[model samples]
Target: AKWREPKLDGRITEDLTINELEQYWNPLLFIDNILSETKETQWLMAQRNETGEVYLLERRRIKGVFLETLELNDFPLDVQDLTITVTSERPESEVDIIPDQNEMSAINVQTFVDQQEWKLHEHVEITKRIMKQEYSSSMKSHACLSVTCRAARRPGYFYWNVFLIMFMISSLSFATFAVSPDKAELRLRLSFTLILTSVTFKYVITQSLPKISYLTYMDKYVLMSLAILCIISVWHAIVTLLDPEHIATKYSKPANLFDLYGLQQHKSFLPPDTAVKSTNNTQNETDNFFKEHASLDNGFADNLLAFFLGSEQMEEADQSAESKTSTDNGNLSTSVGDQQNTTVPRLSNECSLDNKMACEEWKRVQIVEQHVFTSFVIIYVIAHAVFIFWLYFDASRRRREMRQKDKDYRDFLRRHQQWQQQSLRQRDMHAILRSSLHT
Candidate 1:
């Protein structure tokens, strides 16, 4: 808008100066400033032949005046007050700092006629800056710090990715609830899952941000989310490692409710654990199960319970007196033994019978563990799938609704436009008829 058309010098084709101005003051010099000079330059932008397209030489000189407050820097300077006069790349130095250059060079550049003022919307992207510390020829600057910086627009998907990442982290947290406490793999799986979730979060978020040495706001948020999940996983692992009743005490509502009701009648799971009671209980239970076949001593119940929990110790006891006697009696009375053996059961047959029962017990244990892990995993998977699907469905529904609303709005606008056009035609027709009748 501040483009001035210079009159051509009669003999020199005055447009040469304008062409020069255009080249020197190209669009890249898009700064807001007054034309600090009234004198016109005689520089030529470019030469052209007949019916020529002109190209101008582009060069720009800008003087940036800023109040460099004392608080901005911590280092020493040659002068406290300074008014730096810059023309093109050369910035003229002042022996003593000055303000508002009254005049500079052979031509004065402080004021110009009929110039338009431009407003700056944003600051310039300074690729690099040079800071000088000395003014005198004899005195060298203490240091020159050249800084490099770049400008970037914020990513359009910033908030969208944030929501997605948070949703995934929260989903992973929910995933932890799907593990069973009884499964030994639960703790490891939880830790591994949580760790992987954290890693995924890091990977996803790192792509969205600059590589600042210090963590950004979004980084802190995502890291905090991961930490919370890790804590949940760790807490779950610890709880699962503990006794079931203890865990039940900590987590189960029924256990808590029962404890509240039985608060007065509290029975200890490990009351004193006296040696006598432990030993006697173990012996009695063993006698019932083994029928006096095995030898057992004190603390057997506790030891047995501990073993069941995870002691990895098993006691192989001797066969019963009846079993030994039956074996001996069979061999002693060969004839009678032969007749008895034909009628009586053999040891091999008994072993075979017991093997079947042991195998059944093993299968039962396996089935129990399988069902527990399977149920837990399935519950979590289903919950996760449901939640993810819900997020998808909700987003889809909103988008569909928005589209519908937009369609409706456009239809309304079209109808209103048609009505307005019709109304205008009718008014014009009435005016034309009135004019004709008057004429």
Candidate 2:
């Protein structure tokens, strides 16, 4: 019922005979309205096969034509029920029936058919797209958009920009290694700036995408990278601004009741396992090493003793300390516990008189500490550098990496510069401290 061919009718008397019927039937031909809209068109519509999906009633576009409109075919119709009405039929006279002899077919019938054909084609197109179901699926997924646009210049420039940003960031992060561990301000300044940079990046990137509840991989990657860089900056800030020795004391040192008693006697104990002392194999030497050095009856007074015992240099030094103690007096060792308990007090007059001596002793300790610190710092830098290089190389250089590297590098450079400054400042403090021994 969706489509129907326009029907035609004719009436003639039987007495008018076979010749007239032959003449009427001779001119009968279906109009091919779909393709030929001309009223005087030459082509005729004839069913190729009733069972076919479409028919080439005329030699034009009906075959293999991509129908943009809804395709219509194979609908049942009342072709058999068509009835002819006789206006008049008589034996004395012949009756002839026909409409506007110049045009015996429906008028403007093709126009109506064209509108229906377009609607059918449009419906078909819509239904097929809905069934295919491709583009609309984007509503719920976080899949990476695989862009297939043919814009060469646009994508080219975009790729270049991404590369450049990443290059800069990576350079920035890499610069952290060059920062010294001493300066506190450098890390602080750099960290604040990089955090702002990351915020700006987030804002910029978001402008190009729709707001989504679930994060795309790109979003997660950006966020994670920002977090990592923030942490890196924090670490640098801590190392640069804070005094490791002071912090270690605050956090790692166990509290003890006896600390109030000046049990350590103003001695700032270095970290454990950092030095070596000698084992006194002989009874005389063993008695001096523990008995002379230990303040409490407990073995802790000679904790440094246990550390340095493995080295020959420290053993020689121990011998010197013993000789020095022996010079104080033979009776200094008379009561081992009493001698160890007594803290050496600097004399008021000796403050000026022994200025050179105190400075010399401090200089010696500083040199030893410097040697230890420099050796360990070198080892730490080598190990850490290897790790960072591997991480950078192993990871993909997405736009995200570039941004990360930029922020991280800024912090890295700041920390490096700060640490260098801290080292210089430490040296200055040490010099000033030693010089005060004279004043």
User: Ten residues in a row with the worst lDDT in model 1?
Assistant: 71-80
Give me the overall lDDT of model 2: 0.36
Evaluate candidate 2 by giving its C-alpha RMSD to the native, one decimal: 33.1
Report the lDDT tens digits of candidate 1 across residue range 1-439: 1122233222243335663455443222222123354433333344332334333433344444333323112111011222222212223232211221122112122342212221111111112223342554654322111111111222225446674666566456655545544453675676676678667767876764445565544455456566656655665665544434344345323234335434323323221112113544433333343333123332332233222221221231112222334444333233222322332232222222212333343345446546654664565467557644753464334334444544664565567678878977998899899899999
Tell how far residue 421 is off in model 1, in angstroms. Answer: 35
Candidate 1 TM-score, true structure as reference = 0.31
- In the range 22-56, model 2's lDDT, one tens digit per residue, is 33322222211133333332333323222233221
Q: Estimate the TM-score of every prediction.
A: 0.31, 0.27
Clashes of 1: 6
* Model 2 ranges with Cα > 4 A deviation: 1-157, 163-167, 240-439
- Mind sharing the TM-score for model 2? 0.27
